[model samples]
Target: MPGQETDRRPLSAAQLGVWYAQRLDPASPVFNQGGHVDLHGPIDVPLFAEALSRLVAEDGTTRLRFTEAGGVPAQFAAAVEPYVPEIADLRDTPDPEAAARELIDADMATVPDLEQGPLFRHLLLRLGEDRLRWYYRAHHLMQDGFSGHLLQRRLGEIYTALAGGTESGPALGPVSALLDQHDVYRDSAARKKDRAFWSRVMEGAECPPARAGRPALRIAREISFISSEQFAALREFGVRAGVSWQQVLIGAGVLHQHRRTGARDVLLSLPVTGRLTPAARRVPGMSANVLPLRVAVDPDATCEALMARVASAVLRVQWHQRYDASELIRDLGWPADGRRQFGPVVNVLAGDAPPRFGGVPGTAHLLSTGGTAEDLGITVTDGPDGGLRVDFTVDAAYADSVPLASHRRSFHRVLDTLTGDADVPVREVDVLDGVEWGLVVEEWNNTAVPIGQETLNTLFEHQARIHPDHTAVIFNDEHTTYRRLNENANRLAHHLTHCAGIRRGDLIGVLHDRSTTFATTLIALTKTGAAYTVLDPDFPDTRLNTTLTRNHITTVITDTNHTHRITAPHLIHTDHDTHHHNHPAT
Candidate 1:
């Protein structure tokens, strides 16, 4: 028999985050996650009900509720009636499979109330004379992915034993004990060390922006699969590189994100099973946590080197996986203005877990886990045919199907590049598919033009004459009118042509800081019909001098008299006043 004493305890750090999120958005179904199991071969309704009741009576979490224990809300044991599974009979309904799907949809639409006891709910639908579908949903505060998997097996055993006129195995302790263990972990020295490790990992790191825009409803999803050959190649490559397949996938994901955002450092949120002890594993509660994986993707690094770094990082993080994600974010001292620390999350599902229910042989299918809580969520699972299925749930407002489609294509291309040639540097990998390459080479860059008598300077002159009073450019508090800019460029053009002997097809070097004078000089180059070369002032003297010399003779134009690095025949310098004063009309 279970203890009669009230098992009360504070919420775990992860649970506290979930509670706060639930309280903030009461209508969101993100925290409500569940799966359904298909039980074939005649489910005895009454006996199944009794088994569900017995299971609830034995497990303390099923009969658990939340209330104010001392000024703060905490979980405690609640005395509630035995859970009776709701039965939806659709055997006689037309299109039984379709009708059964409607019943499942309706049950999933009903959200659970946290304040009420029995956070876990169940629904059994009759598909035909011998087919039954069982759906189970529980608040994330009570269950994780592993717990859901374990529950299906446990229910199978209970129903099987009852059907055989026997009893199931002894029940375990209350989930409240798991919360107690979590509290103990919070106060341990190991937790302090984990905290320090995360602090170092996340220091000076900013998560990348969402690849897609946020949709109004934000409920779009896409699933892509990789070939069995590619999946096998990934594993074989991992073995050769001394890394796990998960780390290899993560490394590939980081490289993908880098190619997408052009960022050297990538930060991703990864989910880990927080089953720190064997007792916690059997308790069937919310023992999963999300942690940040920060990696620096050096473009010059080889694929093996990058995978090795990711593997080492994964191992170190798993050692300190007990650190509370919510608390770690708090300790990072980031602003609390409703922005999440990470934009994308990657999860690997337990697809290999066998469906062990009773003595009957049937299949278990999970209808839905909660939709993504982040802008983009990628879930990987092993397919029934031994391949890998990757589902991407994205916020539509941030990204469209077009880009994500290409993203999926590029992801495969990247994997091929990595496994095809391990010696190539990451920067050398080309993610574009063959079609994209053909388009770029044959269509996009096919820039053929008709010869025209008109020049760029003539076009600008026409626009200035038509809209002379229009604002041409604004830099800081200064504005240049079209007429004024045209006259200024004409003045510089005359100086270049008459004074500096600049003519058509002459190559001139123009070096200046970002200002109105630089714009004027570029326009003047068009008027003189001379090809102009631009250089950043910040480039090293050796590179600048070498580039100037390799390009041959040069006449340099600048806003300042700093031409010591460039060996030029003539140097023309000009400056303009940018002190908020608008240039008067020409």
Candidate 2:
């Protein structure tokens, strides 16, 4: 075993990618993968400990560590002693369950060092004489989602036999065999073909739009959404359409993204089980790869048609999913910039059989790592009674800023649309349900207000009369009271009415920067019963001249600096004597 520990090997493509990511962000726990399972009515501590130790000795990944040798990342089986599972006795605590939860939370908050040996750790919390909680933490470099379930099954099986006073079965094979097979697959022509297929799928593909105002990097927040009744209908529709539940769920996700982004061509990263051969399933290592699943949804296509497209896309990628995503990205020549390759990721995990440890019903809870590599990721797990549980892990930056409620509601709405009718066109389908529609119509769009034929100018005048000393206009450090604004506007109005022979309905061109002068001129124009058009300072001179001439505006009120540009026959520069006109005994 000591000699075997000296053997170093190159990591698989997927593992290499994760290693680079860890190197890039050393503090992130996004790649820390593990879970907690609670087993009630457990009494055989000795047997459980022995079974756990035996399982670890059998799985080489449990003692594996990753590091850089000669500037190249490599993994080796550490010459460490067999893992002795730690036991936390919380039975004497006031609230055993709460204490156990706190212990589990603390364990999940920490991450293991990859450069160090023993990438996995196990703990058994003694909640009470009959209650036990098992916490297993492993890095993604050595384990996948299915590996977690396998760990539970193997632990349960070993415990069952040992507790029953019988000898356990022979130890399972080490993860080295799986790595050997991966090496073989890496050199195979099939792998090359898969890479080609991926290149075609991702050619010229633009990165998905980032959520507005969301930070580029942050810890992940995991939340679970369960759909029992609605999933029943979704399952029924899948059966009727001759598609798998995975396809239906993926179609719904794609539809939700389409409605969320209004992008007909949507791209998502999908995690596919790379356990193509039976040998891959037995080995405990990361044999999964994330591939791009591109769905082209036609607005006129029916729900059935969209599902069919989803099914076809999924089927096409299934065989080629084992292709190394890192290599594929490199071959595609994606920029090395910080932008992500795709948008949200959708992972439909394999349905795990309910684990029972030593005749005690154990429920598995996948703990969050509190970090994510994508903007968002949705992991769909099978729930009880043929329902589906969706665990959404989103980047904290996005979770805090984006309104995912609308997306959640719209996801169910898409499911409803698909299950409610078989032949309904996707374009005609209402992605918003009744409540969401009400939110849009009743809550958001309630813009009705009584209008008693009062114009903005009349309202301003009334406010000026009532709040004469109130602050009316403020620009930078300059402020003007309502009385001052009204008085200045009245002076201008008098000049326009008497000196310029301004008549009602006359169009006046107002050209000024954002200041009190602009405000005063607008009010003055209204007071003189003449219409005013604000001229854009950025507009071309020819365009401004054409607009003034086309509108038949004879009078222009602007600053002295802009007076030279005005083509109107009558010009009243605010900085000139025109504004110094007496109030004329108002």
Candidate 3:
């Protein structure tokens, strides 16, 4: 039998953030966090349902109903029916695993009701005679990554005790205990100190530009793994360097961002488990917060130096991890606009051992961590065979800009360098592997074609002969036909060769008032087989003289407006010349 609903209580800081985000997009499935575990050997269906129901009844966070009181959002613990696993016998399907996956994805896509009760769901699928999969999903307001693990571990304990006829451990602490922990810390002196510390640290920090357009609930993931041998070497190196393995990974991530954006100051949003006290850790609820971790990268320094800095920063942040980020935003008076305060997030999920159910071997697989507001999120977990598994989640809008596969490969290359040698300069670490280098340097740049040895004047003459009546140039709204322009150039060439005695290999200077005559003068100089240099009318007299003297230019052609600036020995004026014949000059 179920009891009456309890009185409404104020939401926690984390729950309040989730509440506003869901209200903004009520139909978004981004708030749903889901995963499944494959159990081998055997599973008792009825017994498993009883275990799950017991787990749900003991965890009050699972029965929370969200609603608005007056104008502020709040939550109340509602007495709801016991949660029984929905059984899907997929053994008759052609591909049981595939069918199960399709059904799970479709169910995850459906939005959960917030105002009513039951913010979580459970499903069980029979894949084979001896294999079964248990799926669980919950709204972010009720559970986080840590809470999800807690629930799974507790469920296994209950099932094992029922089968062995033994006593199980104590159930989870009441949700009110977690609430009391939050209330005690709200007005404590430690919080004021933390607020002051964060205020100083984020004094001049500006929000980074959004990696994708308007933040959507859609996400894209790419998963990769590192060899166990490499991971061992990395751990040994961490021991030698007096830093934890997580710090080394954080350093690698900071170096990666520095290489990509070339920013000396890199800020990453690190998701922290806000369960510092014993009471908070014992309860399964949303006690997670994301804080900014700022690292100043110096390319000239060694990799070990950066790791040392990261270790120190991590120590300081963990001490003050309970401070709510949203309150810090208010303290700093930042705008409510939806801009991210950091770049890519580097989430390191370590120390999660595999769970067993009643002497059956089981493996856990995460499907989604809810929709990420950050463009890039990297999650590093412990692999099954003692290696390292890295999962990259990206916003679909930013996929084209940052290719998931290439980014993963490049990050792996950086990790390899970090694990191999700490003496290497941060700038020397190559993001591209050998194959990517070959593609970029050799294949992509393989653009070459044979060149024809045709001079500019000869090419112009050929075009004029072919398209004689076509307009060749337009200057100041005046169009000149190719034939007419060629005739003008020929007359100027004849005047320059015979009248001024200009010859091949001579350097001629042209000072012009940007008109059609400038083009005619250039073509005429080329017709005489002499090189020409352009002298702008805007140049000073001294610069013009220096250019003419340096180039050994003796002859000068000018329009009337710029003649005053040319002091060369020989002078030819296009506007003053009277040669108008239409014959080519020899």
TM-score of each candidate structure, all chains considered together: 0.68, 0.70, 0.72
Q: Which of the two, 1 or 2, has more TM-score?
A: 2
Segments of candidate 3 deviating more than 4 angstroms = 1-6, 434-586
**Model 3, span 1-586: residue lDDT tens:** 1245558888889888888878777888888888888898878877887888889888888888888899988888787665767889999999999999998999888888888857888898999988889999999988878887888888889989888888769988887787777888999998999988998887666556444245565777899997889888778767866899888887778888888778888888878888888767778888788788888888998888788888888877888888987787666555344435466888887656677779985688777776566557888876667788889887665777767888799898888888786588888988988888999899999866443877778888988999999998777567888887888988888888888888998888888767777788889889999888898665556667888999888878876666677688777766733234433222
Please give the TM-score that candidate 1 achieves against the real structure.
0.68
Query: Between the candidate structures 1 and 2, which one is better when assessed by lDDT?
Result: 2
Better of 1 and 3 by lDDT: 3
The global C-alpha lDDT for each of the candidates, from Candidate 1 onward, is 0.71, 0.74, 0.80
Judge candidate 1 at residue 12 and give its lDDT: 70
Model 3 pairs whose backbones collide: none
| lDDT (10s digit) by residue, model 2, range 1-586 | 1325468888887687677776766766666777788776845887788889988877777777888889998888777585789998998989988987787667666668886746777998888778778888888888877788778888877888877877666565668777887888878998878877887887656545444332434454445455677777877888876788778888888888887677888888887778787757777787777778898989898787888899999898887878876666556545333325466777776356777776786777776422365466777776645567676666666776545555666666777788786788777766777887898879899867675787877788789889998999877567788888888888888877988787888888887766777788888889889988998654445556888989888778778667777688878777422234443221
How much is the lDDT of residue 403 in candidate 3? 76
- Kindly give the number of clashing pairs for every candidate: 8, 2, 0
Report how far off residue 391 is in candidate 1 (Å). 1.4
lDDT for 250 (candidate 3): 77
Q: Which 10 successive residues of model 2 have the least lDDT summed?
A: 577-586
Model 3, global lDDT:
0.80
Pick the winner on lDDT between candidates 2 and 3. Answer: 3
